[model samples]
Target chain A: MANVSNETRPLSPHLQVYRLPLNAKLSILHRITGVALAFAAILIVWYFLALATGPEYFETASAVLTSWFGILVFTLSTVALWLHFANGVRHLVWDTGSHLGQKASNRSAMIGLAFMVVMTIITLWIAIGG
Target chain B: MRFLTDRKRVEGLGSAKQGTGHFWEQRLSAIALLFLVPLFVLPFAYNLGDGYEEVRAAYAHPVNAVIAIAFFVTVSLHFFQGVQVVIEDYVHGRLGMILIIAMRLLSTLFALIGAYAVIRISLGA
Candidate 1:
């Protein structure tokens, strides 16, 4: 390691320095879905705890969920769920030591996105229709 | 024995004995959740009549009750394993490790209680 200026510390292929490729984008979305899962799980816990407490508590949660803000959170969480679930299947495929090639990987990513849209539409249809 | 010492030399992280059980159980639970998640989500999405009696009736089904318990138990077990790994990476001290262990144990207990509540409510006991 030679003495190098602080600004030139051998760039480690940062995202800002280069365009994000498809595989890279999928990896980023995988991490984001994980964080989203945690947040959604917490909201679930709050709902269950409310249910356990009593009717009044449950009603409060029910009202909040029916509110616009709550609906938005639910919609976002629904999208996150579909995205994560589709990508998770891709991960399961990789776990079995298949689909490591570039073409297969890109195709899987595209399929995952398409599946996410379909699931989101179905989710919203049921959400709004009922 | 000489064989024992040789094995020890090669195996640095001594086997904990229960980790694989935890892993397999978590996986099994996740598979079960594939069905359970949809079952739960559909009812909510439909905005079905959600009176206490209706809720109780839905949960009281043997299939629903059993799956609900399994879902919570497996979810907590998986979360504990994941969070423990995170703590091992970042905590890096005896006290920190102990704190993490305590938190994990507490979380498991909370999950147990929640599961118990679900069972009781479903049974109307």
Candidate 2:
């Protein structure tokens, strides 16, 4: 308490100073995926609208979505979707006052990441193979 | 309104009195989407490589149309609230207020357009 003063203090160590914990990393990923999903929502809405508009518009939208680049973007988005979703469930659990400990939180994060990868692969296979 | 002690008045009650409402909405939407998303994605995945007419026909089913509409509404609401929390956390002052407004409008627009599209296909219009 003696050293405390009114002078401007330097900022504490931040992103550059420390490696984030697993849960923290996953939390950041959740925010990122949420943002990505917002953009994906626009594309999805547009797809539906094109279908309503006419066959020509539908075909155009479909063509773009089925292209290689489109497929890549979609694949990533799907992965993000699953990751965000799984992490969301973890959040809901925490909200209910369960799984609040560091061990449980970290475990949940790994599980969510695993779920994301497995689901993405399965969905992609089904989609591409159909 | 006159019976409460100061501690009782001040302890648990939030200033806005609406935080629980927001929390419940987010959780309820999350629960709905947990099931609906998988259901929605299955048919969507099946129709991935299909042509325009086929895809439209798939969505033309009454059941498909209804689920799609539900998915759109719930997702838009959930997305709006979720992003609003993020904005409130990281942004401040005039910018945050503006963003919250923009997000609300955007989500509403997407929901409206999505519902219209689903209805159009379902009715074979």
Candidate 3:
């Protein structure tokens, strides 16, 4: 708002107004996953808090986390965690002035997607004692 | 235009004076997390269903303790910066400012609590 006018300007096409390409979709997904991970930080913090609080508290937290619902949420969070990390690395690569074109972006998107898929599966497998 | 000395002209990032610094903080933290996440999460993930004593033992290890501390401290900064940008983009006016302030306070508290919890657990105190 600094030094900006209150005059309403022509808005860009609404998100629902048009179908977005994979690039835009992935870009938004990066933000979504980042936000997801932000909230997911709470899960880790709670574990530490419970652990420091004592055995009873730790056991309670552990039980809740290992519950079906908790596992489900954690699984989703893990997906988000991996996607955000992979896509973020893509962004960092772009920041270095490499892969500035759509083709390169698409290639990295494919690579990142593959990495996230494989890693998430392996991680969930190990995590769930599978 | 405001008159600037040579040093200020060259050293200043932009009109707002914070152009690249904020960007750099985000990037640097992302780089740190790039390493720290695997170092921290891979082990923690395996301990997901384990009991309290095992969990405590994991963090009690000095390397794990240090990594946890580093992850929390670094992530507080990253989280604050990331969410602050989101708030700025989506929130506006007085409410936006209020949320940003509140978020800053919360992020600081998060780091403090994380450090405290890890240190206490490490010392078994």
Candidate 4:
């Protein structure tokens, strides 16, 4: 009541003050990855347009994507993709009414994190070698 | 005929069903992408860096073409939904409304261009 009484009273801590839990961390990671992938929408669309354009344009797009910077971005995007995927699965599971507790949430986050790392590693290996 | 102030109307604007509709869309596309991504990405990665004709031949298969189109549409829709949530959370006022519409247009563009590309290659046009 006292806190509500004064408009300028000290407020609850925000992002700066709170040390977020593992689940919270992974939850935000999901949003970040989503945004990253949203941007990659342009790249994927570009790939298609380039292919449809002609051989020369396709080659140019291919070269740009296979370049070092492109590879770096792709790697990060792929990591984000898997991160989002794994956490998304966690969300699906949670929606089913299981894994709803604090401890369980953290454990699930760890599992999802592990899954993301393994999948990302294998995919990157294939992407690089193939 | 009921005339209500803009503030009164919008302040309680939600019909309550909108949230469920949004959730359903998000989940449905998510489930679709769960399958479509693997279907689309595997062949795409496999064909990456291939010659134009070779890639075109791969996409010429109806299955590949269909998957490409479905992937594009679902991805853009899901993206539009996700970015709407993002923008709503981070932005406010008329600017937020404008950005939401922009995201809609952007998603539509992504779907259109992607389908066009796939269709052209698929038909050998």
For residues B1-125, could you state the per-residue lDDT of candidate 1 as single tens digits? 46577656655343554535555564565566567667766655765225555565666678767766766666566556555655675777797689678868866875776587677766666
DockQ of 1: 0.37
DockQ, model 4, C-alpha based: 0.50
Q: Which stretches of candidate 1 lie over 4 Å from their true place?
A: A1-12, B1-30, B47-49, B83-110
Where model 2 places Cα greater than 4 Å from the true spot, the runs are: A1-14, B1-13
The native-contact fraction of candidate 2 is 0.79
A-chain TM-score of every model: 0.83, 0.87, 0.84, 0.86
- lDDT, candidate 2, B1-125, per-residue tens: 59988867666467556537788888999999998888887678778768888989989999999999999999999999899999999999899999999999989988999999999999989
When sorted by DockQ, best at the front, the candidate numbers are 2, 3, 4, 1
Candidates' TM-scores? 0.75, 0.90, 0.89, 0.87
What CA RMSD would you report for each candidate? 4.3, 3.5, 5.8, 5.4
- Complex DockQ per candidate: 0.37, 0.74, 0.53, 0.50
Candidate 4 residue-wise lDDT, B16-79, digit = tens: 4353678768888888988987788767767766777888789889999999999999999989
Candidate 1 residue A68 C-alpha distance from true site, Å: 2.2
Cα error, residue B55 of model 1, in Å, equals 2.5
TM-score order, best first, reads 2, 3, 4, 1
Candidate 1 chain A weakest lDDT stretch, 10 residues? A34-43
Error of 1 at A21 (Å): 2.3
At residue B102, give the lDDT of candidate 1: 86
True-vs-predicted CA distance for residue A72, candidate 3, Å: 1.6
Best by TM-score: 2
Query: Tens digit of lDDT per residue, candidate 2, span A50-121?
Result: 999998998888887888867877888899989988999999999999999988998888898899899888
